[model samples]
Target: MKIHINQLEEGCILAKDILSASNKVLAYKKTIVTEHIKHALKAFLVNEVHVENLLEDGRGFLPSGIQKEASNEEKEKVELTPVKTFHQLYNHAVMERKQLFTGWQSGTQIEIAKVRQIILPLISELKHQEGEILKLYQYCKKEDYLSHHSVSVALLSAFLAKRLGYDQGEINQIAITGLLCDCGMARISPVILTKKVTLTEREYLDLKQHPVHSYNLLKSIMSLKEGVKMGVLQHHERMDGSGYPLGVKGDQAHPYSKIVALADTYQAMVSERPYRSKQSPFKVLEQIMQHDFGRFELNAVNELKKAVIKFSAGTKVKLSNGLKAEIVFVDEQFPTRPIVKIEKTGDITSLKDKKELYIQEIF
Candidate 1:
């Protein structure tokens, strides 16, 4: 039965998962209503709740005169408006980046005030709790992907910084730096930026210089911290001297830049693009850990690996081969590929041996 917030009482059990606009879980189903939860539901303007017929205290949830259940149409009407969730903050940041990117295309200088406005809320949300960076693909749109990529890179970079135990002040600087790392891309021609076909040699060379362009654009902003400016400039530099622009290797690249680079690379792989569909998260992680050794800092990549694919025994997951299974073991060296027991046949399979299969998703 769905009831109004005014009718909510302690001990009423949630019958369905309460989700935010972004489809993020707010309150899981079967959670018993508590005072704090009631207040949160009200603050988020959740007008209705689909609760079990009986309360936790063994009382009827609905009064005798009240409607026992709402129709499917009514259920659809019970949309939750989490105005202050990360979803809202993230969407606004994406639009803010879109507008800023457009302004940059026309020779507008980087506005530190507007930039802070975009970064602060996001940083605050990050401080509030650790978010699932793997789920950021839900917000990416191929048509406006540049804006999406900017915000996601910033978030992933910031997440890596925090996981690395950086202080809040350092984390804030890294977050802003990550967002502006691609600011140089604005200087590139739109024709080149959005080209669907292969780029000519000249165009490819020009695109590779974006980090230098980004550095020049940020160097003029006096209020920005020194490291923030440097991070944007060196984001593309690889640890093994394989990267472009200055081609600085090892410590020549700033530490913050390495975090941004790691996040930037990961986001690009998982996000959908016009030329190719997005790959599985496990697949991306597997490739990153297996193939991209020495290209990215081990500490940053390891932290991301631990956070994204935290393996535990008995965890239910769907396999790439379209079979359901329970994880039975996790090899620390290759966490992305774990040993699992097939659900139907009760047979064990080692993912490292079967190179073709990987985890599709966790249920």
Candidate 2:
């Protein structure tokens, strides 16, 4: 029976493994729970668990008066707000993307309409609740990195496009471009994709071929525009002629491709991968500002910084010094380091002057 984590009891056997938000197994199936195990689950932020061998009541250890089940209509009628709806849609997109990639690997014809079905609703929902969408970016799982990264790039691309004052039609097209930019990964081997160690030089070279592969697949779609095709083909191409496939300079690359590239890099850095833990958004932004100015188009990076600061300012955060604080202001000149108000003493600290202090996490 499924039960809340708080209801978990000693001696209860796990029916299934408990997984973290990143999809890593925390507790294995058939493991008997003990007091220490319960504490560990709480520390892992687990919300629910499945227990085997229920008592005669079938409800097991659930407190009295709690409903065991809801009516079909009641369950089906649960209203989802824009953000909640986006989560459901994102999960659907990930599963569908997996199937779509498998079909592509089998040489099946790629369908542009199916891609639209996955991206259009997300774009529409983002127009209403962009902040919620930004907040959800941090929840992307490491295990399903490909699909989650695709969705995240699409969202960030659309957000950046809007910030750049792109028209509605342009925004939708950019979002779709972001969604399929990495579809070429379907042609790569799963072992290379999920390697826990650093890839060798040859493996990295083969991995870089994905952009060209993606372009070849996307070029066959008659419905895709020239700009969209180029975006997928050159999303990895850098402004300084340092990217793969074409090595095109800033003037040589398409503007849409540059936007997607910026979004892609940001999403990849902030996401947890098999090889490395996730970095804080502030750290990623700081790195981009300090080192990536010449590699990415200036306007695209600036717009991304603006979008990030707009949503991230005023959020409660943990400081590097181990103090809890709430951001009070964001300086346009230094977007990464904002003014924060300490939670304990009501002291205002400006991160700009205090270079030693940094934000550790968003609470």
Candidate 3:
């Protein structure tokens, strides 16, 4: 049977090959109709729908407005690269983590170097498509905390480094730094890592010391450079000198460290933490932008804003009204209220320009 993509979950079957028809999709699969899939499908269909609100049964659907229809030639030009499934990304992260962390000793420089080497290429792969990282963040599941967030942060850090115009060598080093930045957590007691209850003051202090713990573990690795070691040490440092292991401030903090700090916070906020649910990516980005510039470099924040906007537009999202819509454009300066087109009617509405609705999250 045919189905809308929003209706399909993790294991649903594709009914048929998705093909372009005259004005509408003809041989599309059940997998092709999802709200998320539809946005990507637009690169193929070139047809964008506008979101709308109707007073009928409270069911959200698109309200028709100005219709910018897709052309056959445009459809032919669009190559819908089969989006790699998030589960596949998740599984890869999980396998890699297990392989690297198992039988590990504290200060196993050889093992750490090997892990860094293996992960650098993957980070580079993701950096080239930073937009994909944003998309993957939207699709991430909550349960697999370790693998998913680790890869996401690495990809994010790599993307940030690239945006800053770091050469390939620097990007690889930073990416490797990000991937292994949290390796110290592996040394902490699992109970503390996944603790359900609030920690005692002593436990809190211990947790905050992870960065130093991380640095100590990495200092012996002859293969790692000063930048890489500094990355692990300063990833948590805030611009205001509130960060741990050393409240190193301003230019004293390495640029790669700054990028990792921003990436780590953004990924952590968007990914599910043990104590809290994941915040929406848009919300997380906005929050970071709003914070005092000293906490994160202004230039880094600006670059991050670009990465968020690139992959975020045309993605399926949940709005404050609980209606589903596709992001149409981003207000680069505003960062939070993006222009969205409601799914049913294909109207281009701006959340910032129009005051009626606000975005809740990427679904």
Q: Top TM-score: which candidate number?
A: 2
Identify the runs in model 2 with alpha carbons over 4 angstroms from their true place.
1-84
lDDT of each: 0.81, 0.80, 0.67
Q: Tell me the lDDT of model 3 at 164.
A: 91
Range of the 10 consecutive residues with the lowest summed lDDT in candidate 2: 74-83
Give candidate 3 regions above 4 Å deviation.
Answer: 1-90, 105-110, 138-143, 344-348, 353-357
lDDT of 3 by residue, 1-363 (tens): 433444333223234555442234532432313334454554433332222232244233333552234335534433555544444544566577656654443434436546654565466346334556765555455555755666777778888888899998888888878877877776777678778668988888888887887787789878789898898889998888988778988888988899999888888888766677767777777678766556997888888787777777678988878778998778777767888888877778788776666667775
lDDT (Cα, tens digit) per residue for candidate 2, span 1-363: 898888877666679977654455667776666666677776655678899867864434433553444334432322222324656767877788778877887888789888888777677767767876445546778778888889889888888888888998999899999999999998888889999899999999999999999999888788999898999999999988999898998879887898999889988987888897777678788998898879998988888777767887779888889999999899888988999999999999999999999887775
lDDT by residue (tens digit), candidate 1, 1-363: 888877777667788988643455667776666656777677565678888866555554655554444434433434444456777778889998999999999999999778877876677676555644666776788888889999999888888898899998898889998899999999999998888778899999999899989989989788999899989988988999998777899998899999999888888888887666676567788888879888999999899888765634577878988999998888887788888999999999999899888887665
How does each model score on TM-score?
Answer: 0.73, 0.74, 0.70
**What order do you get sorting by lDDT, best first?**
1, 2, 3
Comparing 1 with 3 on TM-score, the higher-scoring candidate is 1
User: Would you give me the overall lDDT of model 3?
Assistant: 0.67
Worst 10-residue lDDT window for candidate 1 reads 70-79
